[model samples]
Target chain A: MTTAIGQYQYDQVDRDFLAARIEEFSEQVARRLDGALTEDEFKPLRLMNGLYLQLHAYMLRVAVPYGTLNAAQVRAFADVARRYDRGYGHFTTRQNIQFNWIRLEDTPDILRLLADVDMHALQTSGNCIRNVTSDEFAGAAADELVDPRVHAEILRQWSTLHPEFTFLPRKFKIAISGSPNDRVAARFHDIGVIARPGDDGRVVFQIFVGGGLGRTPIVGQELYDSVPEERLLATLEAIIRVYNAHGRRDNIYKARIKILVQALGVAAYRNEVEAELAQMDIARYRLSPEMVASIEARFAAPDLQAPEGAAAVLAEQRAQNMVFDRWVRSNTHAHRSEGHIIAVVSLKPPGEIPGDVTADQLDRLAGLSERFAYGELRTTHLQNVVFGHVRQDQLYDLWRGLVDVGLGAPNVGLIGDIVACPGLDYCALANARSIPIAQKLGARFADMTLQEQIGALQINISGCINACGHHHAGHIGLLGVDKRGEEFFQMTLGGRADDQATVGKILGPALPEDDTVDAIARIVDRYLQERSGQESFLETLKRVGEAPFKEAAYDTV
Target chain B: MKRAVRVGAGEGLVITANRLLDGAIVWLSADHTWQTAIQRAEVLVSDAVSERLEGVQSRAQADGVVGIYEIAVRPEVGGPVPLTMRERIRAFGPTVHPQFAYEQQEGAGA
Candidate 1:
């Protein structure tokens, strides 16, 4: 029998908490329908429960904390999709699941369904501390320093319905990473914490603050070199309290902690946080070593001993089938345990929405996860699913299963695997469409050989300056703008999100939507020509600079 | 006409709002009910635009219809076409997901 690892099990108290919330929201919905509550008053209530009024209908976002979910939860999601949404759900960059076509009237039922499955939409939206996200490969990755989900769960429990943070100047985002690779884009969050082993073999957190990507993109500053495990919550409280006091309240644009941190400078911000920490009772929030150990115990690694001769079998299968070979090379990642692999199931296909998955697809994935992945799955920041515990011997069968389901696309980290926001088509703030652009690009680079030759590249597209698609972190970024009632795109290059993160630089004047594909083609062609042997697109651009690319893009246009 | 002039769209106004109960795109009709059909929309002419817009606003507030606004539309042979892309898409649905568009439906409504 498979043991559930790192999955948060709700106790009777937890279930009661969510059930009470559902009843409260149900009553609130009734009051709003009867005109007892105005839309102004109801908006926050709905938002706190993760409901949003989109261009077409009310959108409901469900939290999958730290990107962890089991087979049953995934099946439940499929059921919700079939019953409530229009057959599909969109996975977001923050590792949350969003349904774009939900009706406001059906949200109460949806919450109840979610509560039944030990899940809730709590803190998925609203100004309070949103869902704590981490690397999709949290416990399973070989390179992880610690299981980040333990700390993430601790933060989740402490921060839920946090009274002091409910009405912050703007929304607050926190991300954690246990690995040095920084796969979760932790540096881009408002408060990014990285766990590392201290000198005494005890886990410590390296805190980062003020990093965000919106209209104003800024790389985070290092706040503390190392904070002890017990002091994490108190340190976080100090940082947030400082932000809550000094963050701009007058203008919506200047309200985020990133802006305040930028205004105060890293040194001054630290001084304020230090001042707050000095006055506060640190013992109140300090997690005891035993408490932390108990939390960590819940996330014990699966006893998955690799099967003997599995690698040889996998190697033989790879040599026989070229498609399987390419897929294995592209989609499967190195596993923490020997004779196993972490397989990324691509949600992106040619001429389809970037992060959308149908109900049938989710159901199949759930079944597959249970069969091959120890009944668990992970949602990545790139809007893809991960079967984090797949045995090497069963990979061929898993590949066949995925291929049958039309999900065997070998495009992870390739040009075809694009990150795009719901632009003008669905979002009210968008001036231009993002999906069509991404689709066109994906189609343009459909050749697997060409994609492999080009190497790792990220093309992020945003409909507006809100930067939901994380254009700032893309190697080749496209931001859609409206110029005189016409859709135009601005290109940026050389941005990356690793241990050393950097924001992209704008290329030049915006090009018409019709000319964007051609512009991108020219930029890529320039990189292919200028690159030294085995140099990546980012490396080539960094070496030759934007002048050559700009010359090719604008001169051709 | 005065309010239309303020927003820089001079004439041919159509009252639109999201239905409070379902959040569906709806137009204020001549009968004062929020109907899903764009063809059944009450298009206010030059002089009557301001007066009719105010009436629709009050009615919209009372009826729980949200984000009520007057959009510029040009009278056509088949139906009135919204001037801006936003209003046009609102009248229809997502341009990408054409199946979800109101115009593509059998009844052809929001």
Candidate 2:
């Protein structure tokens, strides 16, 4: 038991596969550049390799495989950003990172470099199954019953260019969580799986299907309470097979699995899946106990030993500085290891862009991860990084190091911790810019005292109705709209992404940029004024209903 | 500027596309060449839009460019400027990162 990855580091077979894929893509790029292929023919191929033609330039998304990264992988990303992009890369809501300013001619070489580090741009985009997302604190969190990374990594292997599911009705996304707290927003995926402790002391799968967010946001319903542990993959295949055969293809908007599930009721959908499962060769698809154990054994077990007087050291450090106390209180999450804590690094600094890490910062953080953690870093759906196994005694020193790199913001889970999408600034589909508004809100809540006063709040922002920023799951959701030639923003209140997932409703009319920021301030102020002792913002909103909030928002408009 | 033939759109159009090799924003000049600066672009009169757009489409087929389209623009003292905010940002660059904007280039004054 040590920080070293066990026997299953991406072996030579995977390396050869990535090299072959990159070689094939390089030839395709050459053909396109030589004018042998038109944009129409080349678009899908490029998309399959995670390249997209955005508003200004070509944007390339690199897969993170459930947001896990080693020190070398982090350093590799930094190299790509410094050499290929504009000194920085954007972390997406789906736990991947994107380089915004990439040249078509330079993509093949960039991919070749990524392949050298055992990474490639495969299945990050296109209509095929996207990157499988899971709880960021999968193996380290205290509440976890099973390490979802074991299954998520298995799915990453299973879905990569699967012959049957390569071309579905539309794009598919799957999210899983090992805890009931549901950090990965499982209820809002095409297929949501929860790993829970079964009666016989084994982890059972709880399936939720037909949930998605876009033009229509639907909360996924439970398909099964307890699927046998070994039959998990087979059951997922059955659900996707049914969706592939029957989902609507005429309209792109209606092509998602949620629409199909809604059109045919959940019971009917379940029956169809059951019929498909009955017809398939279930034995071939079954995940054997040995197979599961083998996957688990490949992942390195944390060798975290309890350090004596760690709690006393943490208490003494907190007593030394009030800022350190606030940061420890907010950023420290419970860990399964007794002497360790999960340290959340907020990418959202005072008034800066959320989820953006510079080349220098990435290089420094890679070194820091090796020292504080077991050279492992996890990226959250909320656009933050996690050092999953920091010993309690070394936390203050780690915090000092992070501060030197300008990433030591103590705003984890506060209103300052906002999730925003790349809006009109970079995306072609966006109607307005999401970052500037997020910047305004971030600036408004920059003060640690004010943020702590406001308490644990999530404010999510999206450029359009595509909901890439997970605005539908925010406590205070802001959706950008285009009113004629102008950019307007609409607000929603009381949505959450926890176990009780709920989509927020519209609060009032859409406001212009500055007015929208003011309206949020007014709403937050009203909550602070009328809240009971230690009541959360959502709790206060629920107690008083939406009338007071609605009144406060439109009071000056 | 004359009223556009296309309904629910602005008058006076300027052709824009991304260069195929690098995906950089290019504006069509009066000589039918793609230029990186909007100041070098030739805004088309409403009467000449149909013919110029046809020629540009043919050029796009042969030239190394993708996603060719027309942007709504009105004549300014220095050059033809994009009307919509989206077009303006695309013609320039992302407003958040001003250092990379086309307006930062020499002679393309912001």
Candidate 1 lDDT over residue span A1-557, tens digit each:
23466686666888899999999999999998887888889999999999888777888889998899888888888988999888888899889998888887888999998887788888888778999999888888899988889899999887899999998988999999999999978788999999989989888999999999998898899999899998999999999999999899999899999999999899999999999999999899888899988877766467798779988889999999999999999998888888998899988887778988989999999889878888898998898899998899999999898888888889999988999998888787888889899989988988889888898999999989999899999999999998856789999988887787999999999999999998898888888889999999988887888899999889762
DockQ of 2: 0.68
DockQ of each: 0.61, 0.68
Q: Name the docking class for model 1.
A: medium
Task: Report the C-alpha displacement of residue A507, candidate 2, in angstroms.
Answer: 0.9
Please tell me which predicted candidate would have the highest DockQ against the true structure.
Answer: 2
User: Compared with the true structure, what per-residue lDDT tens digits does model 2 show for residues A1-557?
Assistant: 23343213677788898888888889999999887888899999999999999987899999888888888888888998999999998899998989999999899899988877667778888778999998888888999887788889888888988999999999999998898888988889999999988999878999999998888999999999999878888899999999998999899999999999999999999999899888889999989889988888778876888689887888898999888898998888999988788899999998999999999999999999989887888888899999988999999999999999998899999999999999999999998899989998999889989999999899999999999988888999999998875799999898887789999988988988878988899999999998999999999999999888898898894
Backbone clashes for every candidate come to 0, 0
Error of 2 at A9 (Å): 1.9
Model 1 error, position A52 (Å): 0.4
Runs of candidate 1 with Cα error greater than 4 angstroms are A1-3, B1-11, B45-47, B61-64, B104-110
Task: Give per-residue CA lDDT, model 2, range B25-91, as digits (tens).
Answer: 8888777888888888888766677788778777674777888777678677777767777888887
Model 1 chain A, poorest ten-residue lDDT window?
Answer: A1-10
User: What residue pairs clash in candidate 2, if any at all?
Assistant: none
Question: For residue A167, what is the lDDT in candidate 1?
Answer: 89
List ranges where model 2 is wrong by over 4 Å: A1-8, B1-11, B104-110
